[model samples]
Target chain A: MEILMVVVVGVMFTIATYMVLTKSLLRVILGTVLYSHGAHLLILTMGGLGTGAAPLLSTEGPHSDPLPQALVLTAIVISFGVTAFLLVLAYRTYKQHKTDDLDQLRGSSDE
Target chain B: MSNLLILPIILPMLVGTILIFFAKNHSLQRVIAGITAVLLLILAFYLAHEVYYHPQQTMILELGNWSPPFGIVLVADMFATLMVILSSIVGMLCLFFAFKTIETERAKHYFYPFYFFLLTGVNGAFLTGDLFNLFVFFEVMLLSSYVLIVNGGTNYQLRESFKYVVINMIASAFFLVGLAYIYAVTGTLNMADLAEKVGVLEQQGVLNVIAIVFLFVFGAKGALFPLYFWLPNSYYGPPAAVSALFGGLLTKVGIYAIIRTFTLIFTHNTGFTHDIILALAGLTMFFGVLGAVSQFDFKRILSYHIISQVGYMVMGLGIYTQLALAGAIYYIAHHIIVKAALFLFAGATEKITGETSLYKMGGLLRSHPLLGWLFFISAMSLAGIPPLSGFFSKFALILSGIQEERYVIVVVSLLVGLLTLFSMMKIFMYAFWGEQKIPTEKVDKKETMGLLKPIIPLVILTIALGLSAEPIFQFSLGVADQIMDPSNYIDSVLNQD
Candidate 1:
């Protein structure tokens, strides 16, 4: 089961890296999202395959490690915030400059 | 009060949010930002003294009433406190310059908040005791930087800011992934706890891999060679004031983290890790200076120099000796002041000439002697000239390298220093000492208002640090000792409860 999960993550990561290398600004944003998902999976698998339940131990028996779960939760929120900000920035750039092609934007070298 | 720890992080955020509403009234907004910067400077100094006087202690502030591992903790030690002080000083200087530099009306409302939040994130990143919280703080800083970088939505800024945001976001993801694995292996988020746990896991080989993951994360952020492409471009998009603070404080926070984790949590794999780091440091220094020398624009040159200077700090870590670490710390302090001053000087020149290319600028020495000498002092110090702060730092590092008998690295460092001087002289000849050209007409009184005041303290700071090396070196040595021995930090936090 863990091997299968790792394979799935590997494919996701390869695709993400490919997406990130694209020229469109929107594609780069999607690439970031895919890449983070791959990372999140790598973390889960690295912590030996699970025999336990959710991290929260209310009346449940033998809880899973809550620490990684807590970490993942925070990471998700941060990624979400960044993604939203990026989306807005991409929209603003498209609105102001009317293009998402990375090549269209030549930065200042003289200044 | 222990409670004051929250203010440095919180007040700027609150004041920044308030300023957004009054953005239309630019002068009023400037007044508010001015007051906030002064208050932050005072608070930072107080915190620095507090940490210095109480060495070996961790002043942990738990959010709400939660206990360790349950709540986020801000850990203020000598190192973190020192970084906060640097950030505050940069913040004050940059905001002062912002009064004259930032002209995009659309950005006026959001700029202050993003600026404050950027500092909040930087201060938090330095102070957080938990690895996961560190990731959060990294995001806060990155998100704010993204907004500030692209705020005006100019063509140059938008294009470069996209690359900057994407690269940093990927770096943050690596941090989160690294933290997750660390937490899974150790079931602990607290840095002190991880410090103890990771040492025992090195035999498993998993720990070494995790260390590599962390190195990737921080290496990218710190602009270590090969991971530094995004910086010179993204930073070039912002105005001078924003670029100065970013040049001074942002990347150093990444170095601070690498130092903290390597010293505290990942001590088990030094033999495996430091070897790679030593090689990278050599390359980083050589390539970074080469890049700096190739640049013709004033700000672009400074941007490239930031990458080179970061190599010095990393060299201290790679050498991994007590004296070497102290040298790195002192070098960081010196670099922040000098680099910020150089950038501000560039801004001041831009203000005077309405140009950034060194080719288009000359005769500044004839017109503005004060600016010319200030730039010269900063540039020379950056080149590691003796009798200034930079020379003392590199001297200590080189001596420590010789003591360790690492002759190759020592030679590499000496060559880098000479190249650094060449570039510095190039900037001087092109911008300050050449034949006079028709100067840009001086702006009206209101436009250049309050431009030079913010930089005044930074200039004084640069000279003072040079003059007071003995005590400062002693202080950094103390910080190194504290880091090398974790018991003091561990006991202080655990005993506090």
Candidate 2:
């Protein structure tokens, strides 16, 4: 089960990285979102698959690692905020620049 | 008491919140902002003294008095205190420079809050012992920076700030994901606890993978090599004071994170992780200087040099020795002050000649003697000229590199230094020493307009730091020693009752 999860996450990360490297601004934003999801999954899988109960100690059985779960909760919130900000920035850039192909926005020397 | 740690975080935030209402009143905002900065500077100095004299101490604020793994803790160490002091120093100088430069009323109102929040994020990042909290502080800094970068809403600013915002947002997301994974594995958010937990995972490969993931996250923030493209452009959009502060403090915050993590948490895989860092440092220095050499704009050149200078600090980390890390810390201090001074000098030149591009200006030395001489001193110091703080830092770095028998990296560092000197001289010649040309409307009369005030204190600081290098180097060496031995930092937080 852990190996399957790792392979799935690895494939997702490659696709996400490829999307980010593209010239379209919107794709790049989506790519970032995808990449982050893959990374989160990879972190989870690396911790080793666990069974029994939730990390709460009140449960009498063996528990999952509560630390990674706590970390993931924070990570999810921060990433959500950043993604929302990036979406606004993307829309703003598109409205202003009138084109999303990053190549058109060349170095200063081009000016 | 631990509550003192909250003062640095809360005071600026409260003042920043209050200043937002009085945006229309520039003079009032200025007075209030000025006083707030002075207070912060004093507080930073006091904190520094406390950290220095009291080694066994830490101001660990337990959020809601929750114990250990459950709560967020802000831990103040020698490094965090030092960063706070330097940031306030930069903050005070930038605000003073802004007094004459910031003309727009809206800018005055919003600028102070963003500035304070930026510092808050910086101080918060330095102080936080929890990995997730570090990400939060980084977000706080980045969000404020986004607003500041596009503050004037210039067409150019809007265009550039968008890319800057997007790139940084992506980096922040990765940071979160990285934290999530680390937490999933370790089951604790506290940095000290994670350090203890990371060791229990005997699988070295998994550890190596996590360390590399962290490198990408911090690397994007620090502008290390391939991840550095966003920096030069975004930095160019903001006004001179904003640019200087960004140039000085923002990336250093990222580097500080890298130092904290690699030293405390990832020390187990030094051979794998540190080796990659060493190679990247060499490439970063080489390519960064090359980028500087090609840039024609005064500010653009300086922007590229920030990347190159960061390599020096990273080299210290890659070497992973006491003296080398000391040199890296010293170099960071020297570079921040000197780099900020150079950027301010660029602003001063733009004020006089009304030009940021080197092609339009000539023979500044003939009229603005102070500006020319000051720029020269900063340029020289940046190039690692002897007796200056820059030289001592580089001296220790290269010597330590050679001691470790990393001959290739040592040679590359020296060559980068020479190239750095060459590019700085290029700036000096094109902008200052060439033939003087009178402008269409008595530009010569306005040559000294608004030049002297900002550059004086900065120039004094550059030279003063050079003249009094011994004690400063000793302190840096002490910080370096502390970082090398993480037990000092780890024990303090963990042992706290």
Candidate 3:
């Protein structure tokens, strides 16, 4: 199960890297989203997955580490916030510059 | 007094959040931010005093009463409190300068809130004892900086901010990955606990990899060498006040993290890690000054200098001695004050002449002698001239370097100083000392004075810091002592007795 999860994360990261390298702004944003999801999965899998009840109950069976789950949740929320902000910023860039091509945006003011 | 450790983080957060409601009223925002900034300054000073006088006592505040290695802990040692004090001083001056300089439209867009949020993140990063908490605080600082940098949303700002945001986002992602790997190997996230665990671990192959990962994670943010390409362009886009704050405080946070982790947690292989740092320091200084020398624009040159000065601080850490660390600490303080003052001076000059290019500006000494003199003092101080804060800090770092027989870096550092002086003199000669460029009718002395007002205190503070170098260096030596021996930090956080 952990090996499968690792492969999935690897695939996601590869896709994210490819997309981020593209010039389109929206693709870059999507790439960040995908990248963060990959990171979240990596975190969970690295902690070792377990089939158990919620952390509150006292159970005889094994319980998953609650810490990585908590960490993932925080990471997810933070990334979501950042993704939203990036989208708005991209939209603003599109509105002002009228293009999303990263190459074109390379020229700073002094030019 | 442990509770005071958390106030530096909380007070700014609370003030920033509350300032959101007053977004429509610019004057009210200024009033509230000013008062909160003053309060933060006082609080930071008090924290500094408490930590300095009682050096052995590490003030640790475990949030929600959870114990160490489990709960989020804010640790205030001499170094952390000193950073807080320095940050608040910079924060206050930036706020004051912003009041007069920031566009009303930008101020209406929750500028005060974001400013304080940035402070909250900076202070939190300094104070947090957990590695994960540091990542969260870094995100907070970066997020707020994104908003602050693009406050005006001009074409240039939008473009540079897009690049800035993307680079930082990638850095943050790597930070998370690094954290996950570290936790996977060590099964811990609290820095103190991690230190204890990693100290005993023998298989350091993965540990060293993780350390390099962290160096990259922070190097991007700190603008180290090849990673610094994003800084000069992005920084030039923001308002001078915003740029000043970022230039002064932001990269230092990255340096601080490097210092904190390198000193405390990653002490296993100094041969590999510190050597890498030393080489990077050499390249960062050499290339950074080269970039500065090649730039004719005022703000861009200063921005490159930021990268150069960062090298010196990191070099001190690379030397990894008590005196070297102390010198680095002093250099950090000195750089923050002088760099921020120079940026502010740049802003004032731009306001007067309506230009930042050295070729387009001249004869400021004839029209505005006060601004010229102030710039001369700050620029001289930045170049490590004697009787200024810069000279003593550089002297100490070099003295320690020679004692360690690291002659190459010492020579590189001194050469960088010479180059730094040349570029600064270039700015002076072209921008301030030549024939009057701006028409006499267009130069408004009152407006220039308003801008110069906020810089006066920073200049005075720099001079005073220089004259009182002995006491300050002694204080930093104490800080270096505590940092060099992390057992005290570990005991205070973990044992909690």
Q: What TM-score would every model get versus the actual structure?
A: 0.95, 0.92, 0.98
**Candidate 3's residue-wise lDDT over A1-111, tens digit each?**
989999999999999999999999999989888888998998898887878766767666566689999999999999989988999999999999999999997794464
lDDT of all predictions: 0.82, 0.82, 0.92
Cα lDDT tens digits, model 2, B88-163, are 8888888888877887654653888888888888888988998888988998888888878887776677678767
List fnat, each candidate.
Answer: 0.76, 0.38, 0.56
* Model 3 chain B weakest 10-residue run by lDDT: B50-59
Residues B176-260, model 3: lDDT tens digits: 8898889899999999999999899943899999999999999999999779999999999889899999999999999999999
Q: Model 1: what TM-score for its first chain?
A: 0.86
Superposed on all Cα atoms, the candidates' RMSDs to the truth, in angstroms, are 2.2, 2.9, 1.3
Q: TM-score-based ranking, best first?
A: 3, 1, 2
- Pitting candidate 1 against candidate 2, the one with the higher TM-score is 1
Query: Chain A TM-score of each model, in the order shown?
Result: 0.86, 0.90, 0.91
The candidate with the higher DockQ, 1 or 2, is: 1
Query: B435, model 2: CA deviation in Å?
Result: 1.1
Tens-digit per-residue lDDT, B1-497, candidate 1: 17767878888888988877887877788889899999999999898787767645557777785666566677788888888888998888888888777875844648877898998899889888888778888888988888888877777887778788889988887787787677667878788777767766662577778888898899999999779888888887788888898999889988998889888877776778877787788888889999998999888889889998888898898889899999999999999998898888888888888888888888878777667887788888899886788999999999999999888889999999999999999989998897877454564434433566667677777778878989999998988887878777666655564
